[model samples]
Target: MLTTLIYRSHICEHFPPHDLKEMVNAANLKNGQADVTGILLFNGVHFFQLLEGPEESVFNIYQRICEDSRHYNVVEVFCDFAPHRRFGKAGMELFDLREYEREEVLQSVLNRGTSKYQLIYDDRALQFFRTFVEATEKENYFEIPPADSWAFVSDDNSVQSASLPAEITTECSFAFQPIVDPLAQKTVSLEALIRTSSGEGSAAFFSGLEGDEVYKADLKSKKTAFALAGAINVGARTLSINLLPMTLVRIPEAVNFLLEEIEVNGLVPEQIIVEFTENEVISRLEEFTSAVRQLKAAGIRVAIDHFGGGFAGLSLLAQFQPERIKINRELIRDVHKSGPRQAIVRAIIQCCASLEIMVSAVGVEKPEEWMWLESAGVSHFQGHLFAAPAFEGIPAVCWPEMLSAM
Candidate 1:
């Protein structure tokens, strides 16, 4: 992204052609020498240019432009990446003032003799500019610039050179979502199963089940419950509730009902792990952390779900001090191929370990993956290859029975 500030006052219909020529020559020389290509749009009273090239070269040209006395009231209007050079050709092109009809109101404001560009300081003006540009692009009056194709290639090359394997999409299954204790070789009591719908009404489409449902068969079925009763009826002692950040902010009274039910059902506070998506949690760090801390004070365990992926922030995780961290499947899928990712996971585990916090690896389907995670000092594993999330209640049967059945 490159931005050049141009003095709006210097622009005039009767401005010296020689001065304009000098400015154009300087801009062209800089662009040519640095291999920077961009577009220039000049109205009778203002100039806006989009430049793209090596960061240093662009900055150097901008500095030179700032020192020129022919221009004043310089301001940067637009700046960002483009797919290809919109102004690939050499030389500056002056457009008729009518060409920028959309900016007429801004021009009027600037013509009023305002010392500062109102477009920069006025919120309404800023919004108008954004809207106008968007509308222009949508109407096809102006082509929306394409992002630099080299951007993705450079990113891919960097990842490749670091020996990180390309991301591979794997067929995920909900069959084995149970959390099993390896040492006891037993399905852990009060196991919390993470569930997601599939097909047309899948979470990817319709999202998880929500709303008030009467629980006719639970320990406290008559109570007005907030959770999806269907999961509870199936005998899940500890329910992992997936919450959006907004929902956490205005915690509904129904949540209190759910907590009441947990207590009535003889479930431990530690049994209930409120799983928060990475993006949702970190975005509203202060609010989410405050809510989590409040819940923790009440004896409920808070686990950050899908950690180290999406909008995951290590700093936020440390500050929040969640009870457990669930590692995303992406990092675990090919830890062997990506040393940096593996190192990241190891670092996270070490940090969590030092804080006495537990770590679980999600989407661990292969034996090799499990072995690698175990070697990495990960404590808990969940995915298919172990046992699917059961609709059945806590089995009267023990680990041996479950293993034999598997």
Candidate 2:
């Protein structure tokens, strides 16, 4: 099988530049013997390389390269199988970006490609080259420490019983997970995640419901969420609850119901945020927009949950701007190591920033993921890395003792 691997890394500080020539010569000789061919680009401070050859040979060569002490913050940005090589002639070629002007560097690199036709047609690989040569994505490259640098400690000892009305108490329960600013060491909000009374997920809780009943139940569950938040006395801290978009349209006076519930539970409208998933289609757009206005007028904020996971993202952003957007887990997963994901997320952050909308990342499970998102200007985060959702209670969060001095 043929394999192609593309990775980038930062050159170690105080490293001698003269040794780069000797290192390239050794790599060329070794790779030639192993029947591997690739090109490496160095832009004074960072190295981008692509290796394409037999799967076993390329894998072995990459392992050796990773162990070299000359570079740090290694991120394997792309890996895939291809029918043929793009640079079949050279064992390993080095291009120092410092020697070439930015205007001609990409074309110069393409001039070295053995498969010029493939490079022109395959924009994926070519875009990576262009991005590296232009250095447009340099700002998003965050160097995170080893995963074990910090530990995640879960403290469920402070758990308090989530009191629910007797009628709906047996029907469902709530699990509260915090959205926190790790650097600030503060909880921005606690999201009330719906679950079965025995602690099953939302899927199990709504399995038997159908049609408008699902929307009704989705709206009704918030009453229990509010009661639980009040039970825990989430004073001053924002409480975020998920809601179906249609619930606001289908249920009469839905915003008024929410406002009344907020008062009854000893909470205020400003402290509540209603999150509507972007993936769900809002069948009645006009009505939904009006309801959103009502929500805002009542001092309750609106947010688009799972922002990038669906088709309605840009259109929804244009329709009625939400106060916040939670970048979906799919985009957040492995973002630190992915050039494409990093670019997309950076665009999302920029767009939201311009409109004065806050962006948060959800389902972030790795320290690397959190680091990248934090560096990209997202301050709020939710996921198991800090604290898992507590069943019928609030889970205590574990903050990193020391962040990397980047």
Candidate 3:
């Protein structure tokens, strides 16, 4: 299968057009030899590159690029096992902004699929791409005019990033969604979900970030979740924070910041749950495992989000026995009618039970689905049936009337 990786990095210094082209030419010859393909877009400041090929070839090339020292603060924004290559075997087709029309290149970026870009780059991301292309065409690369942006200007701290406006109170906010333990007749935790104060979806809310902007945004989100959880009086309830595995590897000290926030909020580290996507690719599990150990040592727990998706299967569970595993929505949706889905959920529940790991079913939209999961041994649940995400403070749960009193 073809695996694709999209990475964004900061260019350490300016390279002349001829030097850049030479670099691209050499890369083209090298990648072509290995059947690797992708586009590299640079604005003399930030860069976005997409690489796709046989899994090993892509991984090998990415490692070589990472160690090359031409750039620093490299971050993997997107990666997946693609059904097929998108820009197959380009070797290294440099999207030299100088040669391409500014508007045309920007439009191509805007028109890219959400499934590929939305989760990584934000809506305004195209605008940055356009601006870079414009700068290249005008031969004004070194002088990218600064604007009011919530991007980190430096890497002085452990997160290696800091935002321009240290106090950005307007762009986004945290919304709490309840995760309930139906059998216990209580809320197991409140997962902090992101909501744009302007009331836009995630894609628009997260738009226009590149390079250190990515790290700055993630750090901001972590701090915001804890602060909001405090304001809403999470108190004794478990508070869950969504983190990207990639970000954790980049900013492992983020856990210390989280620890500080918990104390500042009069909360204990034990009440905190560090949730991460199970499907997200990690090139270095050694780094991730170290971070997880740090969290565990600090008394914070971990949960594998979207448990049934990605390359990880039972092997991952056997390797890392996280305190909890969330049943992916694909297995919970309409599980009452789908025999295969039911079987998968049962096996997961039974397997987790044997391992003494708690299982929480996510995206349970109907009572039948809940009923099925509950019968299969999922005591904790999250989804619309309990309550839709409250975009502001904690709204009341629309729990079953019979259990609301209990």
Candidate 4:
């Protein structure tokens, strides 16, 4: 469980190159004993470094780094978990970005790590850290990604419980609703809606779930979503599934479970869009954003579910861009008949368009409602008008014949 801490700051005016190396070398000696491995990059002005080791060791080193008088205005860029150490050792590797050519520095950073993509973040971060942390809450400095993103791949189903292990099976299930694009006359993606096997609905099924139960339920549904798609050989269209952001933070293994299952089901991360609802209050915006970044880094798309339904929905988008936004039904309903609603819907479409985000108009029931929304530049839609959600698997989308006339 190696945690990575990244920060950038300005080297004080007086420190010479020789003196800086001596200091870093001395720290490297001390860090090796603490099992920390990382790279320090100084570009003559700013000092950018990454620290990786046990969670406590990394944070302790960061605290010392923050207190050190050799550098001033130290800004923490990212604190995340690395699946494996990029450098593969317990000592500081120095890179003077100023002394070397761009290729040399990049190769040094990618050494022992994959060439595909490794999280050697922000040498791009000095300016971002300068602005990003200030504009957002400073307490956010403490949130880090999980220790190991693959730690929760529990295939050993041998549960020895007081009750029969078989009795511990989850009662919750899922139904999928397809998001349609009328202009293309094609079904776009399937959104997995949670349901109860007992026919009690999502509210009743998930009512008492808290802590680990929530994570278990989410992991189960996410796995099922992947399984269903694979079983049907669904195309590259996104399989949109709802995710509880806080649950990922609470137990990062939930994320690991999903990632593992994606491989098992012969699916790629690009085909999935994890949606967080607007109804849930974002108590820890920084934590939520970090989890989203982890997902994005894994090639998974993020979306805002039932958007514009809460204050946090639109306001939070300006900070971190998502791949999709499903317009809340309340705003989409009767939009053709209501001038204010249409205006609101238009503004949302424009905002999403500006961000280059796909907009899916959810709850499009009436033909008039669908017409106005399509004219307003929205191509993605889903609701009872197309077809009601079907349990166990995706139901056929009843494409309207009116689309042919149009």
Candidate 5:
């Protein structure tokens, strides 16, 4: 299939301006060999490029561009299939926006198009070029430093020991990982991640279950999570637990059962947060919302987990705003180097901020990922970089400090 990928990046300081001509010449030869054609636009500060060709070739060339040391802060702006190429005339052409007047830049871009009809008709592609030339999206382009800019040091504190009551033992166990504000040096909350009694992850525990058994196991696991949290004396700090949305609908008196368990375990409902993964299909919305209402009524808070993994997250937010939302790991992985991910995360943060909702970045394992997220207005974080999940105990959190070089 014919595909088009658009991206923008800032030139590195070490990349001399005179070398741009040689770079364009090199790109022309390489792209020509792969039957690819596109245009590169430089607006003095940023380089916006479009690549179009066979799906594999386009992606392969784009990957090379990302690894190129000549530029940084690369953000993918648009990507999709096109019936025909817009810049089919060249292997790779250069359009220096610095040379044209603001009003003339748009016309210059249109004139380079392979098809006048395609250029006039393809509003999305044209608008992208126009936006770059007009310097309209500069405000949203956050240029974060490299991830290794700071050092993450783990505090070698011992995990607090707590005995689990015999009655609370179950087929599964709980692993605790803290969501911490590294700069503030405070643990915001500890998420009780479910695991098999054998110390396997949640997927292994759920793999054996089918149908309603899955929901039953999901709801039942939280009881153990609560017991574990209480044993550790979480005190006034909040405790987060994951729940499949359908579990609330499938299990009757689910909210009441949770309240009873919390009370019996010596934890207040106010300190509990039930995180619902967005990927699950809520076949019965009314019933699930009703259960969420009961949770809120009892002082328990609600949060959406895996916020961008599915289409339903925004709809869920519109229906009922949660106390916080965890941005999925897919978006957080190498986010400091990904422009598209950065844009999406920024949008999510802005939307949550407007609604008075908190946001957290989960599954972060890289210092760069955490640093970019922290700069993007996210304070609460859960990931291996801070602390890995410790089965039945709390793990020591890694705190961030400036490197001596800084």
Candidate 6:
């Protein structure tokens, strides 16, 4: 969970900066033991922070923070099961808003305001504290607050909870469907599928195409780009882009270029899911992991595609720590029939869940298969039952729509 602590107090005024540094160091020592990563924000007279890590670490820090003799109007601006970790490491980063030229940017963008060291506890002054932290980070820096103007921060135990929009809680249940070959009773989406360029295609379309000449030509013909453009034109919210390890090694510039296009076309990196094949990723795990880390750092979501197909170990999973893991279709195809296979898959999913990682089953085909997967605690599914990778466009549908359509 992404836990944030907004302590609105005159603690800064009460303690000297040197003493505050010592207290922050102490806090960091406690956090390191608990494996928490967060940033501390201080605006001279006030203090606020966005903490991300295990729940226990955050809670422990909150309890300690309240005891410190800093200023008193403590508030928790945001908290939630963050889609992504905000900070890379566990440390207390101090940001002084007084340094920024445009203080209004904090107020206007994040809804946080500042005041003289005296009126630190005024309710109005505390309103914009989280906003400032969020604007500086420029990410979904906080959980969506419950209301537009105010959020409740329970001081009883420093457990911070925000009031989010009602729609946020009810909207968008995401699910996946298997990709199947209608002719082959045997599923094929589990295999590592690479993008190939065909003759008469745009250079961009052929940028990373490989494999059979015919397939390469087909991919190069601007078909995929046109299809993706069309999907966005029609309001498609997310796009899945498959990348080969060779592509990262061979066409690094092209990868950056496509990422730029994705951003230019009105999609954030978070909306573009990049899938990496096992063979490709495992061959150059370090390079692949580095690339994934960079992409993730840039807010692009990464998926270790075709997981469990190759000799990938749990160590690899720990190393990359991707936001999503798509189990190789082979694992899904015969998992129900093989106890050992099922056990391994279950273990992988359980491990991922513990890390707050999302597990998606790929290449599902039958209704019974879906039911079995759901029972196995799979959070998302993708297969032919959902839709094939077509040049037509990404379908506009919800998780329930896909499920009911099946």
Could you estimate the TM-score for every candidate?
A: 0.46, 0.85, 0.57, 0.56, 0.90, 0.44
TM-score of predicted structure 4 = 0.56
Off by over 4 Å in 4: 1-170, 403-406
Candidate 2 TM-score to native: 0.85
Cα lDDT, model 1, residue 340 = 49
Model 1 C-alpha lDDT per residue in residues 1-406, reported as the tens digit of each score: 4332221223433456447656676777767888765544454544545555666777677666655555543433344443344345543443334445664744542333223433454443334333433333222111111112111111111101122112111211111134555535544323333222231211432233243211111112212121222223424434454455545555544346556766664554556767777877777778767766666766777777788888555776656777778888888884533334656788888888898888888777655456556667875777654543432222222121212222
| Better candidate by TM-score, 1 or 5 | 5
Each candidate: RMSD: 19.9, 3.6, 22.6, 22.7, 2.5, 21.9
Q: What pairs collide in candidate 1?
A: 82-146, 82-147, 82-148, 83-146, 83-147, 83-148, 175-388, 176-387, 176-388
Candidate 4 global lDDT: 0.69
True-structure lDDT of candidate 6: 0.51
Better of 4 and 5 by TM-score: 5
lDDT of each: 0.49, 0.85, 0.69, 0.69, 0.85, 0.51
Candidate 2 lDDT trough over 10 residues, lowest sum: 154-163
By summed lDDT, which 10 consecutive residues of candidate 1 come out lowest?
152-161
Q: How high is the lDDT of residue 71 in model 4? A: 74
lDDT by residue (tens digit), candidate 2, 152-182? 6544445666555553578888899999999
Candidate 6 wrong stretches, greater than 4 Å: 1-227, 230-236, 395-406
Candidate 5 regions off by >4 Å? 117-121, 158-162, 168-170, 207-217, 250-253, 279-281, 336-340
Could you tell me how far off, in angstroms, the CA of residue 94 lies in candidate 5 after the best superposition? 2.3
Cα lDDT of model 3 by residue, 1-406, tens digit: 7887776666656545457778899999988988888778876566778788889988899898877667754555456786655556468677655555655766564344333552334433333344444554232111211112112121121111122223326877767778987656577888888767665656766689776666567667766667767666777989888876767678757778878877876789999898888876234667788888888999999999999876787677876888998888887876654435655777788899999999998898876677656656678999877766765566566544332222
Query: Of the pair 3 and 5, which is ahead by TM-score?
Result: 5
Q: How many backbone clashes does candidate 1 have?
A: 9
Q: What is the TM-score (0 to 1) of candidate 6? A: 0.44
Tens digits of lDDT, candidate 4, 1-406:
7887777666776777679878978999989989998778777766767788899998898899878878754655567776666554538877776665654555555553433334455433233332332333332222212122112121222211122222123675566777888657677888877777654577887788887787667667676667666665556877888877777777766667789988887888888889988756366678888888788889999988878888775676787788999899998886654435655777788888989999998987776677667777889999987756776566666554432222
Worst 10 residues of 6 by lDDT: 167-176
Best by TM-score: 5
Pairs that clash in candidate 2: none
